[model samples]
Target chain A: MQENRSIPVMDVLIAVLLIAAGVASAMSARHLGKSVLEPIGPGAFPLAGSFLLIALSLLVIWRAVRVGTTKSNVDEFKPRPGMAVLALALTCAYFLVMQLEWLSFRWATVGYVTLLTAALFDWQPRKLPAAIVSGLIMGLGLTYAFTQVLYVDLPS
Target chain B: MEFLLPAIANVFTPMPFLMMLLGTTIGIVVGAIPGLSGGMVIALTLPLTFFMESTHALILMVSMYVGSTSGGLISATLMRMPGTPAALMTILDGFPMAKRGQPGRALGFGIMASFAGGMVSWLFLALLSPPLAEIAVRFGPYEIFSMTLVALMLISAVSAGSMIKGLLSGFLGILVSMVGVDPSSGALRLTFGVPDLETGFRLLPVILGMLVMSQVIGDIVNINQPIERVQTSFRSMFMSMNDLRRQWTNILRSSLIGTWIGILPGIGGTTAAIASYTTARNFSKTPEKFGTGTEDGIVAAETANNAAVNGALVPLITLGIPGSVIDVLLLGALIIHNLTPGPLLFQDSPEVAYGIIAGALVANVFMFIFMILGTPIIARLMYVSRAYLIPPIIVFCVIGAFAQGNRLFDVWIMLAFGVLGFLMMKAKIPTGPFVIGYILAPIAETQLRSGLMVYDSSFLPLLTRPVSAAFLVIAVLTLFWPFLMKRRKAPTAPAHLEDE
Candidate 1:
């Protein structure tokens, strides 16, 4: 499936990151000692894997560039901008708020789910109430199930 | 065999039985929904199983697996959509049959065929897994390491999208697994001085984030899209004697196909179903009627996919290699309970092995019963709003991640991987390799290192030993096959580079 090519700029970026990661892994492995007697150190596998990764990442970049230079890229998927941003923001904020102890885990989840659902549905007037109710059920039901039945402690 | 009685007794006991019932019910509901999958459900529910006995957990997961395969028929027949990927072919004939006013009859055929498939495949699973484990027991570290490499290469080659992306994902998974203290040297290799990083990422949260949370986020992004609902009533919910008599051969054939495919590593039920459906059509004297609301098509599709469910368990139980993404979670569940899989599992925890095999049989029976009785209720759930469903799953994802180490760091790791998974999906990269890579990397590394130690760091043994050499040769071929195929197809379409 790699013959027809659209230049994926994002993929190029990922390849660069992968290259950087490989370098970083190699640097990290250098700190761990490896000798002839102990050929397999803690860092041995990581070093080998990272070098393999670096080589592969270069191959990916070469292929991506080759495809982009040859012809126009395929029609790419365009996710709804508003929906994408809102979902991402809410997810990050949910993690941050819970981590910072701004609110109890249960409350933060309830608020996040309720708002996220409404936003995702674009606040259709007739569907708004049901969406809110659904969020509430999900939030509370999960809290109870996890804490009571599963015995998982939610951050308080 | 000595453990068989205890295994049966353990599974039939009250708590495990109840969990199976609950798991089956939940599986049906999740499977009936278009976006949700049995894998995601198991991943999300894994933490809850963390405290349970390994046998009970196996029973629960196995029942859910069976129920989900059966549950797909509800949506496949009612709507044109397959509830699960395995049901994709079912829509060809199932939906058409439902539209032709024989909804109940079509549903009956699917249900009955699924049962027959499950029974036939369960026979293979029960009989084959032990002997396979026995054979696997003889494998040395070199053989094991080479075999693991072969599994990784094969999975990367067969994944849905670009082979390179799949390989990259798998290697990336290996990198991720190497983040903490090295198991061999007792030295911190990649923790970056963070105490949490000392242990690296736990498998549960990593899996939950990628499979469940990523899916939830993706679903939420497209939440505005509406489903096409079908209104239908049940009638004649039983396969006639003549229909059963005529389709017996098809059922048996499809089941055997599924079982054999399931034994092969990395491939899943969808392939089995498609293969069975195609074979059945070719063999049918009335080929013209195959896809035109024919019972033969539904039977072939449903039977094979369900049979594959049990077939997939063979390698998982014996070799510790997951055949599909869902089975990876099953492996994760086993690890969570401190029950290591592989040939030693059969020798050490014979009861767990026997219990799982027995539980699958019981679960299949329960799945058939539940699908018949719970059809009406499950049909309603198919229309449940993504807004409602997606949010709860996210909540569960968080709880699942947090429950793993009772740490916030793991939760963040989950969110990070979720985003990574989402982007990978968007890029047309298959997440299958990533999970398999993540799960198998440690195994491969450990085994390779041990093998090297055994051979005094001579790589020659890997290529000189017959079994190991064969595996290494296959791995090389598996990795190159995609590129070879792509090269052959290159002249046809220069635009197909994105097919990865």
Candidate 2:
């Protein structure tokens, strides 16, 4: 079976995003103070960087297109979108749920770890208990270790 | 010489010695874990040192630095996973050796070389840093600006990827650094009206997000794929004297290379390992054996990386210029202790400088002993499931971000950067330049402005001043060297595939 070697659409999207960011940054830099005596204003460095980023973004797009069109150029790996989405959702959920103050630090961490592990491993009967136990130990153990030993205050 | 005895006495004390031992142990464990890096550990551990003495804090951080740099070899050898960026080269031969049923031998070579490298570079650090400081103190703003620019260019040039992309990543990091209010003018340049923007992005969150959190996310996305972990016998964990004797020259050469690369501003141990590995390959009688489980490859990589760790400290201690990402954390540790890094440090607080130097020597000894004895134990970490390992790393990231300023806002920022880092990796953009760029941007800006003020805003002095001129010339040459090589190699290189 032939391997999938399509160009990453994400590259083009990132390039577009970076270009838009560059334009915004450059425009904002112009609004900052720039005197003849001190031409290297605080904005000057960022403005230069924005332009470079724009150029580089275009280069990346060009490279992506050129590579995508080639028949024999096999890009061996592709990003797994299903896994990517799942991970991002879990990450966002972790932060968002923490902010809502619905659960204490240990409980929230336990829930986050347990749910994420289960989701990643398909919630197998054998793996589920192990995941829950591991979550409990890490969540409670780390909370105690950090607060008491390291003196770091975790959000309640 | 005068400070040496005092420093030794200080480090030999129970608290300092215990802290070094604890830090080394923690660093090795952290660095052996696939997604956790030494810098991440140090950044997280920084807040915990708030109540500790300056000597204890420095000792802990220095020991961690040595142990973490050495710890990376274990995972790289056993699992083909580089625990830290510096260990990337180790995976070239380390895994191959493990696959050939010589995991212990490869690790033995790596650990021994790490010890040699660390000790050799510590000597250089002790002998050279003070004199280097004396000369560096005389540098004008223009020279410093040019030097930093050279460092940026060198890093971008040597970074893995197209040079332009590396440059972009670096500059973008500088753009990120610019988000806070300007330090000199106190004027907001790019905060976009957010109150958090006033303080700019903290290094801890930015670094954790980029280096640690991103890796966790990546590991999560690939958790279903199982990785084989190689085990080694205790007997094979130590090299024979004959084996050590044979590689002495290679070890010395690599140690030198690693130390030199480490001292260069903004560079890190990874580059040192690469340089040493390549140089060792070029000079080897059995060059073909390098990628085929040869001890030479592991020695070169391990030795150079550890040496570079110590070498990086030379600039950080003597000149306030950070030689690597980890040193940036050390710079923060110094500042937190009310000790400023630079030449004045030697005069204003000689004890701190001596303490660091002495700590490095003792830490290296500890790293050597721990790595040799604990090889079998740390190897088990390689078998831990990604599901079990990665989530805790994320938790650490959150705690690390929050601990920096005791703010929840930093946690969100870390999450955002985590996404950004993941995207950049997917796009093949190197993260090293970006992180280095962000860290150096403020220094670059301040130096540039200071230089401009001295030269009455004429940019000519940046090029005409002898030292600054030399540095700029080197930067330009370094930037173009890759292009020149690519052009020369273009005829033999296959088309289309090269661009990808």
Candidate 3:
């Protein structure tokens, strides 16, 4: 049987994103104009950097196409995309709650910690209590330490 | 020399001394836990230093650097998992030795080797950095620009993964650094009309996001993996005089090797450990005994890694150039404290410079004592559940971001960079070069622009100036050296170790 090999989808995606960023940077640099005192301008470095990035990204695309991806290129740990996405979403919601000033730092953090900890623990029945307790301690403890001891002005 | 006494006095004072003790203890315990890194902890701790005296902050961070480099031995020996990348080599012999019923002996050898390495490198850090700074002080804009160029090139060339990918990551970082208003002109660029982007991304948010948040995300994914630890007693944790006598040469040689690698910009303790381990095996009379529980392997690896810690500090203190990832964080710390790093740091902030040197020595001694007495307790920390650890770390990251400027906008920047960092990790693009590029871009651009003005818009001075020319040539060679070695079919260190 012929061995299966495919293009590295991730590398290609990264290269495409880089190319777009490079193009945007070049456009921005063009509008920034040159410096009077020096031959180089505020835009010179970024312009040059953008060109190099585009070229290198092209090279990445070519390499991925020619060499193809192997099984070894994959990470050893099995990626749980579901868990990762959930974690990220929960984090974002927590941030939104804080951003809107819906709750104080302490309570928002307590909710975030409890939910994140429980989610990370796979929401098992036995571990929910432990997760909640941990959330309470971390939420209260960090708030006190940062505000009282460290004097950091967290959102009240 | 005049600053030596004051520096000693600064570190020996009650506050700084106590901070060093606390920093070293925390560093060791955190380092002993698998999946946690010294860089992550230090980044999380950066905001807490906002209210500290700069000297005290430096002492605390430097002590943590020393302790974390030595702490990985505990997990590497007992659980066969390197708590930090620096201990990757230690797992080879350390685990087998433990399995063979000599766990304490293995740890004893590792601790002694680490102490020896620390002492040897401390001498170089004290004696060598001063003169190196003296030389660096005389460098012109062209030379400084070339040096930064070489550092960037060296990191991309040596980082794991394709050279193109590393270069791309670095260039992306440079672009990210360009997002705020142009320093020379008052015009805003790359902000895309967002008012929050006016200041660009602050270093604290970017670093906290990249180093801490990304790792926490990965940890949560791997939270369910079981750990099987090898239990051992502390009875045999002391090395005999005979054993020290027999291993002295290996210890010295590996220490020197590690220190040399550490001075080279962009390489870290992991590379030092790998190189020393390979060299030790090559030089041993009974080389076959290496992988199956030999003291030589443990000694060389532990010694080189710990030695590299101080070795890395040399360049940071003298040239304002970071030698490794952790050194970049230290550079950030120095910058955050309103103290500029570089040769002038010696002239302007001599106490802080010498305080770092003194703090390293004191921290090493503390690391030796702590590891000797607290190994069993520290090893137990490796078993802590990630479910509890990851959430607190995220909280710290959030607070660290917000505390930078007391803005919710900074927290969002932290999350955005966290996602970018996580994607970069998934894509196998090394983060080290990205950070180096981010930190060095302003320096490179400023120096190069200054050089151009001095030379009347001619780039010829870059090649005509001797020091600048030499730096550019070395940069070219470093960029192509891997290809040359590959063509010659020479043995190389494992690719995974290069990422650290």
Name the top lDDT candidate: 3
Sorting all predicted structures by TM-score, with the top scorer first, yields 3, 1, 2
The native-contact fractions of the candidates, in order shown, are 0.49, 0.49, 0.64
lDDT of 2 by residue, B181-287 (tens): 88766678777788877898987788788866776677666665556676566567788999989999999999999999898765689878877887888798988
Tens-place lDDT per residue, model 3, B1-500, is: 67776787777789999989998998999888988888988888889999998889988998888888888998999988888899999998899999898899999999999999999999999999999988988989999888878777756544665777788888888888888987766668788788999998899899888878878777766765667678687778988999999999999999999999888776679879988998898789998888788999999999999999999999899988788888888888998999978887888888889999999989999999999999988877778888888888888899999998899889888988888887777778777777888888888888888898889988999999999999899778767765764665345544433442
Clashes of 2: 0
- Estimate how well candidate 3 is docked, as a DockQ score: 0.63
Off by over 4 Å in 2: A1-6, A35-39, A67-80, B89-93, B265-267, B332-339, B481-500
Worst 10 residues of 2 chain A by lDDT: A69-78
Measured on C-alpha atoms, candidate 3 has an lDDT of 0.86
lDDT values for all models:
0.81, 0.81, 0.86
Clash count of each predicted structure: 9, 0, 0
When 1 and 3 are scored with lDDT, the better candidate is 3
Q: Cα lDDT for residue B221, model 2? A: 65
Ranking by DockQ: 3, 2, 1
Candidate 1 per-residue lDDT, tens place, B120-185, comes to 999998888888899888889989898888777756645765677777877788888898877766
Worst 10 residues of 3 chain A by lDDT: A70-79
TM-score of candidate 3 versus the correct structure, residues matched by position: 0.95
Residue clash pairs of candidate 1? A2-B497, A3-B497, A4-B494, A4-B495, A4-B496, A4-B497, A6-A73, B161-B500, B162-B500
- How accurate locally is residue A60 in candidate 1, as Cα lDDT from 0 to 100? 79
